[model samples]
Target chain A: MTTAEVSAPTTEKPKRDKPMGTETRVAWTFIAPGAALLLLFIVAPFVLAIWFSLTNQRLISPLPTRFVGFENYLGELADPLFWKSLWNNFRFAAFVVPAQTAFALLLAVFVNQRIAGRVIFRTIYFTPITVVMAAAATIWVLLFNVNGLVNGFFELITFGNFAPDWLNDPTWAMWAIIVVSIWQGVGFQMVILLAALQDVPGELYEAASIDGAGAWKQFTNITVPGIRNALIFVFTVTTILAMRLFDQPTLMPRSPGGPLDSTRTTMVHMVDLGFGRQAIGRGSAIAVIFFVIVLILTLIQRRFLKEESAQ
Target chain B: MTADSDVRVSAKKSVGANPLWRWVLYSVMIVLAAFFLFPLVYMVASSLIPDDQVLAKSQSFEAFVPTPFVGLENFSDAIERANLPRVFANSVIISGLIVSLGLVVNSLFGYALARLRFPGRKLLVGVVVALIIIPFEALAVPLLFMGAQVGWLDTYQIQILPFIASPLFIFLFYTFFLSIPRSLEEAAMIDGASPVEIFTRVVAPLAKPAYATVAILGFLFSWGQFLWPSIVTRGVDVRPLPVGIGVFATTPPVSWGDIMAYTVLMTLPLLVIFLIFQRQFVQGVASSGVKG
Candidate 1:
């Protein structure tokens, strides 16, 4: 059957080699709608982003737009709020990526065990990922209230000494967002890592145990290397998501990027400028710069993954 | 034996072999589960009670339980005050359009890229793959500009159209189509089936998993979409549920019970779908993670 299947396609290779006939026409016709949308939405907008960044454009301005090359970029860099927003993006990714990754791996490992009701446990763990971020933020805003459940728990645990206003206090506001982000995001990474964990051959664990390897040692030597690609993938994806933080911060805080701008991510900043302030040129510059930062981070991650795999 | 001990015995060869260690693990898991579940449970509980009682009960364990139950008044109030029924309809229409239209367009594009011998097929695939890395947030400003320029802003098409032809979904369908055996298509060709017919009959049926993955992901994405909709949509006319609920939550004279009710109303549909299709949801997410 395998030989027959292999030969069948090759047997018709002569007829398939003809260029730009009905096949090409049919293919292009099939592809036209999606291709047009992609070009219009993605490609053209990307090109316009660069062009708009170099001009003095406003969402609604009386003055005609003109070329002001790199001024927008320079002005954005000079602004302290832009730096604060960029730092917040980095700060968010810095905490969320590692913390969420570790928690997810822990949950994955726990659910990967042969314990009964592990499926139930996994389903419960992954429930948050299915909840819309806006709803999740709304749910959490109540919990993060001054006299809310979280503070109630803290008061109980700390004997009534340490309950802070979570979303209002500048010191605690970013941490509140970070905690909510991790709580909401960890399940997604856990699900992926759990799949990867299942793919790691059972024999490897059995073999390691037979060789008298301890659990931690087996994890580092066997399990880590086994799911290395997945680990890196989860890390990179989580980092990208953390950098793109918008919805939670937008919805959870007293205002979008409020509590003295404690959680103003770059995406939130770009939106605030482009739409809220109507500074389209500056917003476009921020968008372009943000894209470059994410692109650079992704490239760096790819190179790092490549080097690690090469070794 | 209790279910816990049954789990312990069944998992003997597993890491939780020793009873003491098993107890510890179970304890930790129970704590974690409570931590994960308490907020959601509290939201539901709060949604069922009066607005005043929600904050009053927060300091005690009673917060997790519905007390002085006002029944579904909060939900009704949420619907009335937030104009939720219209927002709900808007969300359903927008997400439905995106998911349905996306499946057809992306799947067709993917199928062509996978099977057809076209002039720029390789280049198109590469471009799609490259496009996947460009986050939508980066393009939102320019897209907004373009939307405003062409008067596409504050319209359903602005939200639905930009997202319908996703590079990631296209690539997902492309890869899935590639994995279908060549012999099946060859046989269909021998039977005098056109490319379109072959896709509809032979190929699409086999690609149900791919379609399900895309549909679920697309619906979830479109339904939960916050930034883009919040940008383009200025009125409740075309505003989806997430942004509606968000604006409702932030508006003054806040009622925790009503907000929770709104949130539950926003979240319940997806949660029900998720529970029913939990395995597919997990597998879809996992496969996307692994492949992408």
Candidate 2:
């Protein structure tokens, strides 16, 4: 065939390619309902929240609302409770992210093996994650009760009458919530890591074994680098989850912030201010601030992980 | 066959000498598994004990043994006392509606992103990625206000409406749809099938795995939802299981056995579904790959 024959076929295909067609319209039709729902439920509310945050709003009021320029933001910034909860949130994140990520990775490495009963072990490890929120919280509440299982265990280990109210004592409540959070969240991190671990090529391990590398050497040089992307993913997710801490404290605490606001995470504080105290503007400001903090932390995390990967 | 023969020879020669290493491996795994399993065993053990004995150190571990096993009395009392049945029904309705709506909505939005030629498509994607980071806590107050304005507070509408469309689900579906080879759809179109018919018959069926992933995740999030429902549903009239269980914590004369029974009840449906989709669920999550 001549060069012209081949070039003619390509030109003909371009000419005959059906005109921008009905598929596009059909796609929009199928997509509109969901798009519209998101606009109403999510996008619209977000805009309304910004507006509400700028005004002195009340849940039950017919009074004319007036805009106050940055007053709510300033007020929340100055408020001791707001700052305290913000600090507590940092502490919660500091403890949870490292603890859960390390523990999950350790568990995954041990269990991702060709061993007997591994399936059963995996299921047993992941079962607490499936426990519904309320049930899990209640069980923990019982476990942390002044004379609860934890105290009982502590007493038995100490060989004496040694019981401190795990949830009630101000010093211990936040730690109690952190412990349960790790228990509930580590399963998710483990599954992600395990899946990544399994994806590493078996040939790489065999190659390392041929070089007389022990398991520890092989893990550091091969497995860690192989699953580095997954490590970043799990770390980011756990950090996000830790920052969004709410339900654990709200459920476990005797009050909104048990024992002197020790367990009062920022999310819980925002809810308490907005709903419990009926300060919608203050609550919205807190939420907006909360969003900003999370955005900054996430950006910092991404940059740090990128640098780590580059190194 | 070569490696098998070699491994057999090596295994017979080395088995006796590796006893310490084998014990170490098994012991480490056993300890690690126990760490993960401890809380659950404690939860079950605590739940079976009498209310007084639940918090009392006087009772030994023997008290928690299932010997004089209490019948389903704990479950019935928990159901009545915590008003669990109503909450369970509410949870079912809310989660079911969200899952159904999410499947339809996400598939549609995903298809649009995959194939449509709409303006600002890139911009919309950007908005969604940003929104994923804006924690749900940030949206709670605004959603609550929006729901109240529409006369949806204290109703199932408030519980189900805010979550009907998940950005995470949309992102997953969009990626899945994009991966599908275009030839299949092109062939359908050439055969004179309309876009709607082609999509329903070709694209939709091929996207089953994606749909299943979206459904299970949507259901889990809605089922596990706590804060939004609590904020919107002020009364017991429309509260779901999580809220019901939260209220259970504050009630006087709380029953440990019944509370455990309630916990068991709450976890049953989700556990069944997770087990059923265990393989697919794992694949789906892993394939999403580095997403929130």
Q: Tens-digit lDDT track for model 1 on B30-64?
A: 78888788878988999999988888888789998
Using DockQ as the measure, the top candidate is 1
Q: Candidate 2's residue-wise lDDT over A103-209, tens digit each?
A: 88887876676556777777766766777666677777877777666766787888856677778888889988888888777877887898888777666767777
The worst-scoring run of ten residues by lDDT in candidate 1 chain A lies at: A1-10
Candidate 1 regions with alpha-carbon error over 4 angstroms: A1-20, A308-311, B1-14, B246-252
| Candidate 1 CAPRI assessment class | medium
Regions of model 2 farther than 4 Å from truth: A1-21, A304-311, B1-19, B42-50, B57-59, B247-252
Model 1: per-residue Cα lDDT over A1-311, one tens digit each? 44554454455657756644788789999999999999999999999999999999998788999999999999999999999998998888888888899999999988887677889889989998878899888888888889888888888889989988988888888898988888888898998999898777666666677799988998999888888888888999998898899998888887899889998889889999999999899999999998898788778778877887699
- CA lDDT of A10 in candidate 2? 45
In order, the candidates keep a fraction of the true contacts of 0.69, 0.51
Candidate lDDT (C-alpha), each: 0.87, 0.76
